[model samples]
Target: MKHIIPYIAIILLATVIIYSNAEKERTRITERCQDTFSDAIRTEKKLLIKQFCMQYRQENSPNSLSVEDKKDWYDQNYLIATSPSRHQLDSLFRDGAHKINRNISTAIGYTFNGKNYFSGDESCRKSVIPVQECVYRKDTISTTDIALQAYIHIPFYVPLQNTYTYAVVLMASVALAVCFLYTRRRKKNMTGIPLQELPETGNVTPVIPRKVQTEKWMKLTDGYQWNPQNHMIEHAGKTVILRGEALRFFQKFIVDKHFFLSYSEICRLYHLKEETNGAKDRAYHSIKQLKDNVAELGIEIKSIRGKGYKLLFSHRNRQII
Candidate 1:
């Protein structure tokens, strides 16, 4: 029984050793595959590597390879060869003979049989010769070896399948469409002038030097306006008339005083200062007109609730001519 036990132990040990050796050989083959084609894969032709693995394995290890060995041989080579490197192929090859550690790689051209080796080749001799010298020199040959040609073509098809450029074009087209719609609305509004008849300037009385000073004061006021050029007290436009009598009165007050006044203060001077509409319907219409005119230029009139309406100019607006 004891003798049988020892034999069994020996059998297990042999099995372990055989497993380890097989694993090492598989790893070595994978590394050799990568070193032979790393430059080709990185140059964006990875299909060549897959083809090389498939053809090389079928020819060299047909019946011997287990499922795991077959998968590892191809997958490992694909990963290592396709990885991005700090330097490009032209630069790495130009450096002339770089050594990758055996822990990370297998010796180049160490396959079961060298791809270019012929059975009767004198240089190889088949018996005592090292495999390295007998293998075809990659530096001298620009063409891919027969085994790798198909695998290296995979990257070429990747860019054609990409959809990002189309998405960018779609977004740009949508933005252009929005701008076109807004411009059409504004042009329509501009052609039609509201309240074109001149109101009586009579009994409105001339406030001379002060009126001239008010014109200058309007220019220095801290506010943005849709038509700053036409905001002078003397200037008249359709926008001002549609605002009812309050805007005209507000203009009269500023001209009479020779300076700018806040909206609420202007409302008070015109006796339409209350938020209620009863005595102040003119003031409400005036404020609405100002907001609408600025809106045409892509600007907004934002009311500060307790304060007053402020003309907010958008940076995107084209400066009014």
Candidate 2:
């Protein structure tokens, strides 16, 4: 659980960054939709106004123009601009939004005199449209008495190569690479030098090895050394750490051994009740573990039937022999 902290932190940080960027992008798209709608409407209005103006001028001469006539003309043009049907509104919005951003999708909504006159998308009829990424806008226009509103919205997206997505992916890749290298290096260190690659050991050099020992490190025989602090044995450039019960057994052995430990003595050391199979099993398992860890040193824990255990060396590893 402790080791998982850094990755968890990275994930949370990535989430925040991505969310922040998405919100910023949504806001940007909303504003862009507003701008695009205004521009398209403004441009379209200019053309419509020019076309109607020409028709009005042709129908009624400037000299004969009356207040009613001008008002009537304004009313007709306003209806044409604001009161287009659902199909027309959708086409206008879609085309207008796409002109600005080719990938964008748009829906039309309109209300006249406070009643929903036209709504394009079904979800737009309710709240947000069918799509999650969308923005809405509605504006009121007074033709004469009734209030007319033209509603439109555009929805854009964050591009694939946007800042937040790229940043998170890059960070994840780097983190994985670092973890892999760290594990590989640790594994290599623990494995040490392989025996097949080792140089052959010469005959025993008693003087040189004896000089290297301190009170805490015992040079057992010749090539094998017992490092008490580390609970390890080193022989012929190979090292092994004694683990758990094995370590405890070795510690007791170093302090109390006179070459052997009776089964009762082992039981006392481990606080196991005497005259029980548990004590014998505990002693047996621990010594077995100790024996395995020091196998490279050719040290063995020999069980004495109906008695206890003693450490022994095969003739090949006993320098004097």
In terms of lDDT, the best-performing candidate is: 2
lDDT of 2 by residue, 28-113 (tens): 55544544444444455454455453233435543433354344335434744565554443566567667655766566444434
Candidate 1 TM-score, C-alpha based: 0.20
Residue range with the least summed lDDT across 10 consecutive positions in model 2: 131-140
Steric clash pairs (candidate 2):
none
Off by over 4 Å in 1: 1-266, 272-281, 316-321
Q: In model 1, state the lDDT of residue 223.
A: 39
| Full-model lDDT for every candidate | 0.37, 0.56
Off by over 4 Å in 2: 51-77, 80-83, 86-89, 127-164, 183-321
Every candidate's CA RMSD: 40.3, 38.9
